[model samples]
Target chain A: SQTIHQWPATLVQPVGSPLSLECTVEGTSNPNLYWYRQAAGRGLQLLFYSVGIGQISSEVPQNLSASRPQDRQFILSSKKLLLSDSGFYLCAWSRGGRAEAFFGQGTRLTVV
Target chain B: QKEVEQDPGPLSVPEGAIVSLNCTYSNSAFQYFMWYRQYSRKGPELLMYTYSSGNKEDGRFTAQVDKSSKYISLFIRDSQPSDSATYLCAAPSSSGSARQLTFGSGTQLTVLP
Candidate 1:
């Protein structure tokens, strides 16, 4: 079975500070990875997706960026956090094509 | 208009009742549909997936998709309090990486004991 791990499970970052969130998938290789943010009372917003190492496609333009440093490791980063960046961040993985996605426990990021 | 639309219902239902959740999409090119359930403050969990226009059942959950109408639905039978959560509908676009899913604003469902 495949499992995705994201951390820290909860984060409290001060305004203008830098941010870094990591996601790693075990038991799967060359999986499609995605980063999504869910605002309070809103739907999941796709931020970035990676097909392979060093390949990242950003869906939404914001204060965040993503990187696939390794086949199973994805990272979401921000040079400067904004108050609007507060949300529930999720990391998901799929085998490619129309396969069902599996998600991690998610990280609750509160940018104060 | 958004590609996918879903009612943001804080729908309340009693235990053992049948529950229905729905979403409508504006894009006709969407071919694959899926339903996801998210617990409060948790990641969305894939519940059911359907391709094109048809119905698929898994245990207590039923997923229906109508490509001609661009509508999709999820039904939960014998609902329990543990089933309470937000439901999100997703459809894959026709463009690159058809696996990329476009999501609808989720509907929150609560099953009372």
Candidate 2:
């Protein structure tokens, strides 16, 4: 079975501090990975997605960037965080163009 | 207009009652429809996936897609308190590797015991 793992399940960061969130998948290779953020009472917003290593497509312009260092390892990072960057971040993986997506436990970021 | 729209309902229902969650989309190019459930502060879990138009059932859950109307629905029979969560609707376009998913503003459901 395929599973996704995300670290620092909860994070509290000071404004303008650097941020890093990691996601890794097991039991699958070459799967597409995605980064999404959900604000309170809002829909899931697509931040970035990667098809392969070193390839990332960003949907929204922000202070954050994503990288695929390995076939199953994806990282979301920011040099300086903003108050607006606080939200629940999710990592998801899918096979090819499939509609079914498997998500990790998610990271709750609180920027104060 | 947004590509996908869903009512963000804090809908409260009694246990054992039937629950209906819905979403509508304006994009006709979307070929894949899915329903996801998310607990508080957790990630959304895929519950149902359907292609084109028709109905698919899995256990107590039934997913219905009407492409002609660009509407989708998820029905939960014999609902339980454990089913309390937010339901999100997602659709992927036919563009393949682009594989972007458009999401609806989820509806929060609570099954009162």
Candidate of highest lDDT? 2
The 10-residue segment of model 2 chain B with minimum total lDDT is B92-101
> Lowest lDDT 10-mer window, candidate 1 chain B?
B91-100
- In DockQ terms, which candidate is top? 2
User: What TM-score does the predicted chain A of each candidate obtain versus native chain A?
Assistant: 0.97, 0.98
TM-score of 2: 0.97
Clashing pairs in model 1, backbone N/Cα/C closer than 3 A: none
Clash number by candidate, in order: 0, 0
State the iRMSD of every prediction, in order shown: 1.7, 1.1
lDDT per residue, candidate 2, B63-82, as tens digits? 99999999999999999999
- The residue-by-residue lDDT of candidate 1 on A50-100, one tens digit each, is 888998998888889999999999999999999999989999998877557
Question: In candidate 2, residue A54 scores what lDDT?
Answer: 95
Residue ranges of candidate 1 with Cα displaced over 4 Å: none
